[model samples]
Target: MLQMLHEKGLRAEHCYAAGIASIGAAFVSWMLSQRMESNGIARADRWGIFIGEWAPTFIALGNGLRTYEK
Candidate 1:
């Protein structure tokens, strides 16, 4: 996937950056949930998991863009 993105002109660096950002977002979401009084631990965990899933999609998009660029 990295190779394909490179071939298309998409940089691995961009994908990596996006992945990092997604991770950060997930972390923030989790943290916010943790602070919520009404939602509790289970809610926080669910939110964290949901946000966590976004990281992969961002990474995949980045990879696809890179491939296309190449």
Candidate 2:
């Protein structure tokens, strides 16, 4: 997968940027859900947590891509 990603021109910097963006997106989604839903803060928290989980995967991918680049 890493090889494929590298071949596709996905650099470590891209993944790192994605990771940071996802974190911000997660926070935004949480706030949006909180304001728009009746399920309240719990639902918002879950939304935040779910999106927040993607950051690690992106960061890990960034690391893997860095390795491949080397």
- What's the distance in Å from true for residue 43, model 2? 0.6
Model 2 lDDT per residue over 11-64, tens place: 999999999999999999999999998978999999999999999999999999
- How high is each candidate's TM-score? 0.68, 0.95
* lDDT (Cα, tens digit) per residue for candidate 1, span 13-53: 67768788878888898888899748588888888888788
Error of 2 at 10 (Å): 0.6
List lDDT for all candidates, in order.
0.76, 0.97
What TM value does model 2 have? 0.95
lDDT of 1: 0.76
Candidate 1: count the clashes. 8
Q: Which candidate's TM-score is highest? A: 2
